[model samples]
Target: MSTIVALSTPPGSGALSVVRLSGTNALKILKRLTSTLDFTPRTATLTKLHHPDSNDLIDEVIVTFFEAPHSLTGEDVVEISCHGSPSVVRQVIDASRNLGATLAGPGEFSLRALSNGKMNLAQAEAIRDLIAARTETAAKQAARQATGELSKRLAEFKTRLLDVIVVLESAVEFVEDDLPPTQTNQIKEWLLFVLSGVGALAESYQSGHLLRDGIQVAITGKPNVGKSSLFNSLMERDRAIVTAVPGTTRDTLSETIDVGGIPVVLTDTAGLRQTTDDVESLGIERAYRALNEADVVLLVVDGSVNADWHEAGLNSFDHKTQVVVNKIDLVQYGHSDLPQGILVSAKTGEGLDDLRAAILGAFRGSAIQADGLLVTNARHHEHLQQAKIEIKEALVALDEHRSEEMILAPLHNALRYLGEITGETTTEAILSQIFATFCIGK
Candidate 1:
């Protein structure tokens, strides 16, 4: 691989900046750029950077070197820690490039590490996700996966699949040589075991995705229904405009909050109402769109007013809806009549706890155990779905007493699909697509 270099830190001023270089020429290039040439590998040295062409001192920086095969990319690596000034970072990068190192592309270093067996494909993806994580829970989940929990489990499953494949192949190869017929029941049992195990992993993606991307909760209600007030209350901030006027809020405002460690995106949308004003109508249209796209809908209703089931606005939503009766302090309402709905006063903060509990209940419902492994990425979800289909096909072939050779194709396909998630069987095109989402130098 050609020597590649990039700025590892974000593009801005900070306490320190890191310029990374990897590949065969990393050590040689470092020697050419710095005055301290005799520094030991894996040791940090304070040295003066020299201009390659003029041999003049440019900056005094701390440089660290990692010998090949032990470094992040499994190649000779050099990291120069210098002042975070943009000009200083640019000068160092330019000096390295002039010394014959090519600029590193997005995720090139991590890609190199994967190519060299330092880490698997899944770990590489986890690192990327960790870097881009927007919430603490998302970061923790990515960190867990990056630490190889998922990889280790997948490896064990792969071992079991391989064992089954070996047995099946042996049965097919020796059948004509007085070999006893393969026991159909044993094979069925093995297939079921593998299928069930994989199915569990595949099903985990539902909760994983929700944790990673967060659930979108849209507040929808008629004008003057306390939608804005409830939105602010849920977010615990004055993010939305609260006014006594009916049509005060005519746009959607959004904020993210952590609810029981799960990120929830709460959107305070324009009040739903029939209005002839052009701008108000546009806002109402957007409100409907937000309601359609949301994962959960909070239908805020004024408790002081009677329920209006005949409103056409309520008919638009077909999702899991939670009816939140706001301004409950004004009424002597009890929880008995409304078993499923929650009553709260956004003004006085009355019954907000029940509202939050109900919100959490509507989404998770205490059924999803936190200890279960979850798949978070759509790509992984799709691959698992494909693998499930392949396994089912293999099972059907076995049930029909088809030849063992007929089952091998689907079995192999299933293995391949599972392998794709861990990057055991991957292509450059797919790898490029995956890594391209990362920032440069990761």
Candidate 2:
């Protein structure tokens, strides 16, 4: 394999910058660039870096080395830490390339690690997710996945499927001969067990996708219904313009927030009304789009104003709606006397806890488990669906007493699909697609 080199740190000035190299010749190339003789793996050695052609001192740096199969890419590796100057970084990269090291591609280090069996595909993908995570909960979940929690679960499921496949294949091979075989009932039970287990995992991707991507929440209501005020309250900042005049928010304003350990992208949309103004009309059009796409909709109603709830089309939001009665303090309304909808006063911060509780309740009431295993990647979700279909086909074949060879084909296809998740069985096209999403130098 060719020696690959790249800037391990983000492109910018910082206290320090790291340039990484990995391959069989990594140590050889490093020996030529530095005068220091005491370089060792896992130990930071202060050394002087020099330009290869001029033998001129570039900077005093720290060099660390890892022997083949012990490093990140299962090859000899070197990391040079130098002062974070753009010129210094560029010079170091140029010197390394001159010494026979090729520039590393995006995620090349992690890709090599995966290819060498140091980490599975799921863990590799998790590393990228953990780095890009925007919320505390997202980071925690991604970290857990990177640590092999998801891989371990998937491995367990694969093992069960393999056991079932072995028995089914044995039945096919011996049914024509006089060799004794397991009973049909036992076979049926095994098939059902595998099916149920895979089915549960397939179902988990729904919540997993939401956790990774965040839930879309829309704040919508009529003019001057405290929509902007409630949006600011939820965000705990003055992100939107608040005014007593109606239709102040003539466009959608969006911000992301951590709601009960879940990432929620909240959109404060314009007040819905028939208006002649072009800008307000456009905002209203966008409001409807936001409503249709949102996972949850906060229908804000003014408690200070006597609103005709029936005329406001309150039920139009259907199951996704959470009616928020804002400005309760202005109406002298108490929590005990509150109506069925959540009560809150954006002005005085009254009953906001109830509104928060309602949001949490909506999430908890769904099929998602807070601590359960989640499949966050869309690629993995698609593969799981395919595997599920294959398992169903196998089940049908078994039930119909179809030829054993026929059932094994779909069973084998199902195994291959599961293998793709961990990259045990994958094509170059799929690997390219997965690694292409990673940032360079990762």
Candidate 3:
């Protein structure tokens, strides 16, 4: 492969920027730029770099070298730390390109690492998850996966499956050499064990997806029901413009907050009320849209007056709807037959904790911590489900004492499906699509 180069650091100016190079000519190009051949592997050397053509000074940089077979890409790798100017970063890349290095495509470094056996397909995806994690819980899960937690779990599943497949294949080869019923029972039992494990992982996709991509929560109510106040109270800051006038907020405003390790995309929308003004009508229309998209809707009501459920923009309440009585300070929340819902004073921060708990309660299992190998990716889930179906088919054939060919075919398919998760059997097209989601320079 040709030597590849790219800016490792983000674009624009900062304290410092990193430029990475990999492949056979990486060290050779670095030597030409610095006009020195004495860069020690794994040691940083501060030197002045010059353009190879003009021999003019480009910039003074700190360079590090990693020899082939032990580097990130299992190839010769060189990194330059230069002043963080877009101009300087671009010039450094151009200087490397002038010496026979080509710019790397998106995720080439990590992809090369996978190609060289440094990490598997699952681990490569974990690196992306770690970079895009929005909450601490999500980050911790990604970190564990990147360190081979999921790979180890999947390896155990594959081992058990192969053992069953080996027994079934042997039975197929020795025609008329009838195996004992005990061995057949053992093989069937082992297949059941593998199927149970795969099913459990498939079931965990809901919590895994919630951790990777958070849920949306929309706060809605009639005019002047302290919806904006409740939003600010939940955020613990004056993010939205709060006013006593009805329809003060003319558009939907959104912000993200962490509640019990779950990322909540909280939206404060305009009041749900009839208005002749065009702008107010548009805002009301958006409020209903937000309501429809929200995973949980908080219906705020005035505690001092009789509640009007119709004006709250709902014919009936679903499981996602939670009633919140605001302005608890303005009226005595006495024990009466009036209805039971969470009462809060958004102006004075009363019952805010319960409100948060209510939101989390809506998503009962979404606040799960990354304890073990919870399958998060949709691709992984799909493969696990397919593998499970094949295992069931194999089990059914074994129970019926049918021809061994019927059982072995599904067993082979199950093993291949499991292998696809770790990239042992993944197609080139799927690999391209996966890596394309990654940013260039990895």
TM-score of each prediction: 0.88, 0.85, 0.92
Ranking by lDDT: 3, 2, 1
Residue-wise C-alpha lDDT for candidate 2, range 193-229, written one tens digit per residue: 7778777877887677767888888999898989999
lDDT head-to-head 1 vs 2, winner: 2
Candidate lDDT scores, in order, read 0.83, 0.83, 0.87
Candidate 1 TM-score over all chains jointly: 0.88
Write the residue-wise lDDT of candidate 3 on 168-224 in tens digits: 788878987876989988888899899998898888887887778777999998888
**Highest lDDT scorer:** 3
Name model 2 segments beyond 4 Å from true: 51-59, 83-91, 98-100, 168-175, 178-186, 243-251, 273-288, 307-319, 333-340, 363-365
lDDT computed for candidate 1: 0.83
- Worst 10 contiguous positions by lDDT, candidate 2: 177-186
Candidates sorted by TM-score, descending order? 3, 1, 2
Give one digit per residue, the lDDT tens place, for model 1 in 53-103. 998777899999999899999999999999898988998889989888999
Distance (Å) between predicted and true CA of 239, model 2? 3.2
